[model samples]
Target: MSTITPHKLGLHKILKHIPLNAIFDAPAKARLAKAVNIADLRLCAKARAHKMVFDYLDAGADDEISLRRGKDAYSQLEMHYHVLSGLKPPIDMRTKVFGCDVDIPFFGCPTAGNRMFHWEGETAAAKAAEHHGSLYGLSSLATTGIAEIGEIHKGPKVFQLYVWKDRELVKEVLAKAKEGGFNALALTVDFTWYGNRERDIRNDFSIPPKYSVAQVIEAIRKPAWTYDFLSHDPYTYACINTDVPADSLAAFVNSQIAPEFDWQDAEWLLGEWNGPAAVKGVVRPDDAVKAVETGFSTMWVSNHGARQLETSPATIDVLPSIREAVGPDVEIIMDGGVQRGTDIAKALALGADSVGVGKPYLYGLAAGGTEGVIKALDILKVELDRAMGLLGVGSVDDLKKRGPGLIKRRPASVRDYPDRYAYERGYGGGVI
Candidate 1:
């Protein structure tokens, strides 16, 4: 087993000089999470005006156990320490995903109807990604088209695909994404019928939106988000709206999206794309392997932030084995529950090539716009640096070799011990 050294000391003392205070507790603001998480971010969203709208973003299918589990999954993994490790030099979160290199191990998942958040909306999120040196996945369903974000950010832009009943729409999006200089495409496979999001059911949040009296009252609560939201250009991506010509986001999603999508669709789409496409919404090893055969350059394991389906109760709990199945050659990217830097280390050590973080940066976007996004990335990067140093490592590459064997799994993670700790399972057993 490797040992800890004194070189790992002073992570906190050093970060003290870096000014995390501005990120977490801006001199002018109160609790940022409360505002961003509740009001400006979600609580005040037009979704609140209509339950259907809320369900689209806030609720989940069935009992929402899976949605709840996604958050809990992160809580289940505990971090251990190597007290005396010599982690003197700073740790770098920098890594290469797909072809382009990223400043950190995390990236942004493409979101739709961003204009609903603010006029700057998708634009704000894209700039935030560039400023942080991370990849931005733009949704085909985005209120903003691929070209807008692609032209703006020089780093990396990944196009997110939603399989439509219209093969023409699918091909058009691919051609547009390619034309716009999108590097890789990620296809979301799990959502057949949009899940029954109870919140949206209650709020009736639509594309153009049908604001109710309560929604108007709800919008009035968050002054800042409301102002920016109303200031935008008619506030929607006509690029997507023109495709469905539906009056509501819900109607468009239901009418145009295909629920009978299968693995064959993956192969067909791959033939059309002619680029390094990845399959999003993967969890099991069989599916990962199947996706690999379907012509995906990589298999991304995610629970769609537990927003789309409720079938799998958790995502993080299953990554270690997915790594073993895909092996080292195929890239494995995961998201859903990466609140801390240590969580980033855990995913990499388990064999994920990289991960996509959703809510954390979304919260940042909601809180302070572009600056908030920067702050969120700063928090994760700082934590990653400190955790790496404490673990006595110098780089993300080195940490991949450092696993539970380097230090004991914290007691809280004991129930997950059998699977997460046994990393040599090869490709058959989940225990790997």
Candidate 2:
């Protein structure tokens, strides 16, 4: 029989309180005040949001293997902290991305349909980003219009574009982005087709969400969310032109994708914008290289938050290779599974110019509106500052200069090697 340790007893006691204190009826501000970290914010959001809405924000493609892996990859890294290096107060976390200075190395990602989560929607997120002086990304499928977001967020903004079957519509949107004072363009390339999001399917989730009997019960359970949703303007794809009609909103959105889009087409779009642009979903080294050649000023290394592909490698795991492929000059923004300040530091140390976050801020938005979002950003900023101080670095550039020397992959656990013979033979029993 195995012996029980004091640490184990302590852990068990902590676990017991989790369920006992699972309160969801508190006011949004009160609940948000207790959230000291992104994970805490996530819990608050989960308690406040409807089941379908929470799942839509939280779940990923099919088995969610990529989502799990993306987070696992970050957790597997061990930082080589430097003690007694005499780092001064107020660590410099500021960095420039897309030719705009940001107070932190983190930025918001372009997530669609924010209104489903909170009535304030993208405007709340934009307000939080502006407050933090972090870049904000506006999705093509945003619940708020492009011009409105641009007018609201005075800080740097990137307009994420999805190529549509209608070229004229695409041009019109791009023109609108330019007029709205968006600093740059991010052409998202990985979403040629929607992934099989089983959670959404199971919940019967849709744009302008339709509630079934079970979902109605769920809405009643989350009375605060339901009340706010009902009292607000009816949810619609506020960014898309209303004239385009289809059998269902989902069908219309899905049918808008130009499946035959290619590098030539991407180049054409780049030419059309003729300004600072990033290719937002390049994961492969070869693809990263091609993005630069095709005139993209930055390569956004992402797997669409692990929402598009099931088994794709974590964005952090691919950052170094993409950086090497694109050389030192081309900017790289690492996205997906960034839950901590350490994750941001690790990405910068691995060669990312900046990192983009999607679910964290969205979780914050759901938990406490703009206040929650600001808290989420503040948590990351504080964490990153602490990490930089502990790492004996003073600025973002110093962390990047130290590079792989400051962090390394943790060795695989023995349990990961069920086939010991294969491991000894150097043939496939290790973690990928």
Candidate 3:
């Protein structure tokens, strides 16, 4: 081997080239640039947000078995890569979701109280989604109003709706969405009542956050987040609170959510919107069929991000059957535990018309605001393009057409053998 020289090694010179002032001037961009994956973004978010805030975004329902399993289920299936298939660079990721053209197969899932995660909030995330040529969903409980997000994101946008105890309130929000030029309505049917999220209890986390001495101490540790939170407009449920005022999120859920909401209410809501509509929180094959019969244009295969149910099946595990139940014509938007671009491929290959991601984008929003959200979308888009190229597919349509042939479920190990029956039943190794 030739002897190494100081000039050839150049290890010391590497540090000199790093633009230190640029990094200092734009710390958020610097921090986001370092994240290579959704997991890295989560770590960045954890570092920036207070424990209570971060946990709220990160944690799931009661044991969080479903939450952990959602990501795990993606690993259970293996892709069969094709070699020598004549596929070229720049794989086409374009697809129509929620009646709007999108450049990618995945869209942002509607999540609540974005302001709690960052001051830039829903608008920042929406803007990023717009930039990526993907759809952004605004939650019924979003801190940003419908008009605001509509104004910012000119691309396709969907507004999530919860049928409230007050019918007029429901109609009012829908009217605003129409006026605001929202593209679709996603009626979330999972949260009849809030699931037990123990982390929130342990931390005493609430909307309009109650600052105890311990919380104050924790907030002080994250000075950047604290300064941003304090400097911004006070956080509220900007859409619905104008008509129905409640002191706390728990109270709002208890008093506002119509526990008696049924399929009739969903049908009624569909009639009212009279546009592209989706029934979110659908997982069961039977429920998927019912959603189609109920006049929904799409069935959003979700378990509320595993937040509303402790042991619900991972969305991916149930996607194939749901697709079969709804047939090829009905659009299926699968959401939950989509942390990788490979996951997006798996969902499409298995039969999802499109995919929706909640935690991944939220993690990005918490990490670096608008740029962070854009970074998260960029990471997924690049991974998807590379994954498709390697898998010998040139377009999302081609991936979907190949379908089950491109992927195979791994044989159940001894640990997973006992739950094989449940998995076959699409229950994610647990009984319904």
lDDT of 3 by residue, 1-432 (tens): 843432236533553454342333255556677788877787778778888899889888997888878888887888899999887777999999976789999978888888888878998899998898898899888888888888898888889998688888889989999988898999988989988998888999864446668887988777666656554545678888754422267778877888789999889989899999999998899988888899999999899988888899999999999998989988889999888899999999999999999988998998888888898889888888888998899999999999689898987663252332132232221111
Residues 218-316, model 2: lDDT tens digits = 988887776666555555565677444211456766889887999999999998999999998988999998889889999999999999988988889
What's the lDDT for residue 277 in model 2? Answer: 97
lDDT of 1 at 65: 73
**TM-score (C-alpha, index-matched) for candidate 1:** 0.80
Candidate 3 has its poorest 10 consecutive residues by lDDT at 423-432
| Residue 270 miss distance in model 3 (angstroms) | 1.0
Model 2 scores worst on lDDT over the 10 consecutive residues at: 423-432
The residue pairs found clashing in candidate 2 are none
Total clashes for model 2: 0
Cα lDDT tens digits for candidate 1, 1-432? 632321134343444455443443242144343332212333323222233333454555676677656654554655565676666665677888887799887877877776554445677788988888988878876777677887778887788888789998788778888888888989988766676666666666554444567766765655454444443334444455454532366667778788788888778888998888889988898989888877789888887777776667467778877888877788878887666777777777677778787766665555555665666677777877877787777887787767645433346535552332111321112210
* Winner by TM-score between candidate 3 and candidate 1: 3
TM-score of 3: 0.89
RMSD of each: 13.5, 11.5, 11.7
